[model samples]
Target: MTTNILINRRSIQILRILVSGIFLVAGLNHLLNVEKTAQRIEQANFKGIAYFFGEPQWLIILSGIVMLSAGFLFLIGYKTKWAAIILMAVLIPITLTVQVGQITSLGPLFKNIAILGGLLFFILNDTEKKLI
Candidate 1:
């Protein structure tokens, strides 16, 4: 029984780390390409959301910072449950408002949906046990 519990704990830790790593890498990419990302945000044209963050360079920078911070927290498994939830909250708007009709490739569209599903899984599986 003790060995089984130990194995389960280790499995959960690994899963958490893997999930966090994905966000961390994606966040870093966003931070690295702020200008391009901002342009994408502008293209999104999400009414007030774009206007608020598009014109001001500082707001763009701030958004990158927030994404990086939240992603890092998630990757390190520090408040991972909340971090995943925050990520989902931040991503859903962009997905709906920006990528909804613009996706020209089926691969990318499926990828986006897969990412959302993964986020939902993380949110729903916020428990003491490992899924894998």
Candidate 2:
């Protein structure tokens, strides 16, 4: 007997779109609501987090733009590895600086890290594997 449980290239492409679309939407949402973004960061309960980021509200909007743009690249299959790297670049620092102090209690931190992990898998694999 034989089994075929794996997906093919087109399926992978759609999956990639779906994955990257998540970041794109999130970033766009953040940008559209800078005040809410700033408030959430402020709610981090880490005063130094804002001070460390410098110009917190502005930085929030900037990063939102970054994530949106990077997601677009990844979605369109342009410079894919680089796009993943860019997303990670934005993700890791924000993860560490903004959430590290309260990581143990923050669900969002884990979700962000998991997304980063997915992006890493998307970048490092043999270009034909599927990751959850």
Candidate 3:
């Protein structure tokens, strides 16, 4: 006997919400803790990337804004592909600058990888009718 669980639209939307929630919360934290988060970025293995972008605090704030807005869009199933692309753009540098090359960050690194996989789902298969 084989059990095949059919995934439905509601299931996918729930997964989308679950995936976007992390980015939404993280974005809020970035904006709320700009100084502290910037300091952490300054101490990361690739602080130069942050500096190259601009002031670490400003970068944090900018990324926070992007993540928060795009994450909300992603959660609400509107322009999901674009939102996922935007999020993946923000996530890559963060994962590289903060999580990579750190022994203690393996768990978070893999978590981001999993999140990437989830976002990739939207980017690859989001075929809902567009509103704009």
Candidate 4:
């Protein structure tokens, strides 16, 4: 029983770290490469939404802030549900703008879908019990 519990704890910890890592890295990229990221956003199929938010650079900075903050919270298993919710909120528009409607981007689209599933897991379940 103890061994099983240990395994489950480790599994959840690993999963949490992996899930949060993607956002952390992406957040850093947006923060560090605002112009390039903005250019990518501008070139996306649904870039109008990016413009709707404001200048693409500003949007990218906002996104980076949200992702870094929420990603850290999620990684540390603090306020995880809210963190997941925030991440999902940011991800939908990004997925739609950059990944959707492009045949070549199917892989990234599916990857984002899977990431959504991971975030949904945190939102729907109290993983805190198993996390510690």
lDDT of 2 by residue, 1-132 (tens): 655455477866886687797779878987899888777677665646566768877787888898899999889877777888888887876777657778566887887887888788678754544433
Please report, as a residue range, the 10-residue window in candidate 3 with the lowest summed lDDT: 123-132
Better of 2 and 3 by TM-score: 3
Write the residue-wise lDDT of candidate 1 on 1-132 in tens digits: 233323455665666666556566656766787677767766763535656445634544655566678778766767767877887776665565557666564565566577667667667665445534
Q: Write the per-residue lDDT of candidate 3 for residues 1-132, one digit (tens) a residue.
A: 665445577778888999999999999999999989988897888887778778888889999999999999999988999999999999998988888877876999999999999999889774474322
Against the hidden true structure, what lDDT does model 2 obtain?
0.77
The better-scoring model by lDDT among 1 and 2 is 2
Model 4 segments more than 4 A misplaced: 1-7, 130-132
lDDT of all the models against the reference? 0.63, 0.77, 0.88, 0.88
Local lDDT at 3 for model 2: 52
lDDT of 3: 0.88
TM-scores of the candidates are: 0.67, 0.75, 0.89, 0.89
Q: Check candidate 2 and list the clashing pairs.
A: none
Which pairs clash in the backbone of model 4? none
